[model samples]
Target: MTSVLDAKTLRKEAAEARQMADAISNQQDKDFWLGIAEGWLELAQAWRSGGAPRSTKLKEDSAIGSLCLGT
Candidate 1:
């Protein structure tokens, strides 16, 4: 049977998966990281639609991070 994930668990899993991606050195690793990021974004969106409050600071910080990455 498939398991269900609560928001907090999903968040933790997503972060851990991302860390794994970072510790690798190959195209496959980068793709894995992208997948983790997508999963987190999906979960975060669902949480928002489910009436959870958004973290404005998170968005602001991430935007700055993206700028630094130049991606």
Candidate 2:
């Protein structure tokens, strides 16, 4: 739950950074801001799936079955 909230916040920050980057005149500064935006967006995407049972699903989908879990 917290992760999902944080991810939303991060994505908002990324949008702000992108806007700032677009407003800047200096190429270097623009690039830096864009980079920050990209980083934030990536982190947000990672966090957005926080509640997913990814590991368990992967284990279940494995062809090697319980061997993947050392069972």
Candidate 1 matches the true fold with a TM-score of 0.50
lDDT of each candidate versus the true structure? 0.58, 0.64
- Model 2 per-residue lDDT tens digits across residues 12-45: 8779989999999999989877866766666566
TM-score of each: 0.50, 0.60
Model 2 scores what on Cα lDDT? 0.64
Global CA lDDT computed for model 1: 0.58
- Evaluate residue 41 in candidate 2 and report its C-alpha lDDT on the 0 to 100 scale: 66
Check candidate 2 and list the clashing pairs. none
Superposition error at 59 for model 2 (Å): 30
lDDT of 1 by residue, 1-64 (tens): 1276567766766677678778878977677575655556555666757953343323424532
